[model samples]
Target: MSGANKVQKREADAEPVPGLFTLVLHTHLPWLAHHGRWPVGEEWLYQSWSACYLPLVRVLRTLAAENRRHLITLGVTPVVAAQLDDPYCLQGMQHWLANWQLRAVEAATMRTASGASPASEPKALRQFGSREHTEAERELAEFDALWRHGASPALRELLDGEVIELLGGPLAHPFQPLLNPRLREFALREGLADAAHRFAHSPTGIWAPECAYSPGMEAGYADAGVSHFMVDGPSLHGDTALGRPVGDSGVVAFGRDLQVSYRVWSPKSGYPGHAAYRDFHTYDHATGLKPARVTGRAVPSEEKAPYDPARADAAVDVHVADFVETVRQRLSAESARIGRPAHVVAAFDTELFGHWWYEGPVWLERVLRALPAAGVRVGTLSDAIADGFVGSPVELPPSSWGSGKDWQVWSGEQVADLVQLNSEVVDTALSTVDKALARGGSLDAPTPRDFVADQILRETLLTVSSDWPFMVSKDSAADYARYRAHLHAHATREISAALASGRDDHAQRLAEGWNRADGLFGALDARRLPGR
Candidate 1:
């Protein structure tokens, strides 16, 4: 049978396969508007936008056009949603896209060719430029047409069409394990609300920031109307064939199938390391574009072979077949072991596609199509639950998808200072907001515009973001992480102090200035700040 006919037969089969598979992609980035550029700031946001978001959306739209549904589960944190829809970021992204096209032109014209080390590669650089220029034009046109308004419109299109399931999390991606309970609840409530405001649909699932879980968080998830969430496989003790209920709550916790997930990405190896794939680290200095492939493990970046699109495409085909066979065997084995149809889930960061792994999106699109053709069932987490891919209740312990599958990454000795800073600043801000509300005799009323309390809460939330601690622990842009944490902590302190001192005018000015930078989650109100 033809490929299309095979897919139709598989979809039409009333008796399902022995198991099911679901892919989850968690999308997140800290608030970067009004932050620095280049080394670390808006540049991170723009690069992800042009590379990952643009192409990933294209792939989804293509699949949707073919009437595909529940292709994947997409968890977009409210912090990222805010940046995608913000006016400043929207305008900045346009300039970034246009600049990329210009850079491509410069590369093709040899206006900025480097003179160091390589003399036999001018032709290769020009070819790379031509390819990039074409890609940039396509991305720019897509941006101007579908994404000009912000991410919401296009995202709503996918959500409304049932092309994907959207997952929502707290306003800022805070590590809920160490966060104050009240603040945690408040952030989650506002976050779901922000999602509803933007997408016109509130998500019933969340990515839960780092897959971090503390035991009673299930109750919190239940309270926020979250029906399910993701956790690492080790948290489920490796029995990851189905979703498990947490501590008597109706909410389900799905664990990533590390056996299958690590096939695509692991600490030491994955498909991205294949010799024919594009090299992510090696760049041509002349045009600031990567031009090499992973020629070999021992090969130096300068000596790596020039990337060939056809070679990488062939590699994608091979990797897709391998992944399909892996999932098939896994599902078959797990079903026999459990004496029932099994469920397998693999989750990763959305930015991994086309951002970190250059050919990731293509591989993803092919895999989604290939799985069903191979008689393997695929669906979202919600679909899996509805289809009864659930098991006995599990009393999950304190865990996160971090280095040690524990809280050490965010709360370890390496970040003890950040943990302490978060605790002290959160306490001070909460108390200050409480007193301010009490004095107003309007503790339950909506917060007024320019209220010092709003900005105080904003900065406080930003101060405790999970990104800072993760960056510090991993030493990836550690200085930028420290700078951001301290910056927000300082803002929270200054604003809270101004309000406490009855310097209303000064506090308002400070709040306004800060809002010009971090003013997201407009629906957030001081009255919603839960008191300890």
Candidate 2:
């Protein structure tokens, strides 16, 4: 057989037999508000809200409207959920949606005038009054009206309405495997509690931060009432089974199917990189914004023209149909092959929706609609587990979807200085906690030593996050990564100095400084854990 034919045959044959297909979307971003705003801060939050959140909610609502139980699982990290539920975020998202409507109108006006010559009396003016332009204006007007209402209430309504299964992860979306065990436990517990409080129900599953996994992490999840969580493909020894329990915790770990997941959003190559999609990196210098399709590899930014939503919307429909058909075929064939049902799980970062892939939300909605018509059932992780799909027992090797699927991206030599600082912070904080607890010191009360210890814990966790080094390695907002690392490192150093000197005044001042700079995690009390 020819190589192309063989490839086509393989693609046609790769279907899940006798199994369910699951889609898990991880929605998370670090605390960007109050930290950074313009070039890369609130804009990041608002762009994601416009592209991913609002659209996703719309899709779920549409499914609900049809009286169809379209089961899909979603992970909203504590930090991201906190920002989404905040009044500022709710207001900001409304304003952002309004601006999007204005931009769409502006695009429509520009397209209507495309035939006009600079010196002419405007032949395009007649085109602007045409039926198509009027319809475009009406669509934009409707779009603006839909999202003009507050996003928080809509989000809360989605959760309350059972449109999608909500999942939670550790506070700040830290890579848990590399975190200090005590701090990791605290973060996981607090994260679950925070989700329960905010959403009015405890999340039974977690999208482990970055899909990173380790052996003993299950105990923490089990203790925190998490019934199921997700890991990368390799973490489950290449098995695409659902609800595999780790240890005696009864917490099920679902491994992602690499083939299905990479089809939509891979690190090196994916559907989103297709030439038809909008180019994320290259933007027009004139407008200081992204306004072109990725025509081809050699197409330069200056040569690219303004984006046409009509053209992009058509592309989204094609991709969505392909995706839905792919899922349907895989599920049907897999069910027949396995004698029992089989599952194909596809997972991806939520930021890829609107923030990275401009028309992702459109694709998402179409896919949701297409799946039911194809006879494929969509389910959440908990639904799969509750149905009793126990996977084979296997020891998951250490893994992350970061560079090389190892710690190199986060703990690589490039960030050796920051890594060393993190190590020292963890060690010193552990030592201080151990010493204070051994001497009958009270964690509930505020003492000079206790305050310093708390500060050290907060700074240690902040500096130790894999996000800083990972961002630096990718060169996406490298300066912001460096600043965050330095800030946390400084806090670590000052606290260490105060502890070593046994000076109450200096310790208090250091704690105060750290608190003033960033104080979200200061409330964390790690002493409650056993043997602390």
Highest lDDT, which number? 1
Candidate 1: give its CA RMSD in angstroms: 2.1
Model 1 alpha-carbon miss at residue 403, Å: 0.1
In model 1, the worst 10-residue window by lDDT is: 111-120
Root-mean-square deviation of each candidate, in angstroms?
Answer: 2.1, 7.4
Tens-place lDDT per residue, model 2, 445-467, is 64333666667767766776667
C-alpha lDDT of all candidate models, in order: 0.90, 0.68
Pairs with backbone N, CA or C atoms under 3 Å apart (clashes), candidate 1: none
TM-score of each: 0.96, 0.81
* lDDT score, candidate 2, position 361: 71
- The segments of candidate 2 whose C-alpha lies over 4 angstroms from its true place after superposition are 1-18, 87-153, 432-456, 495-530
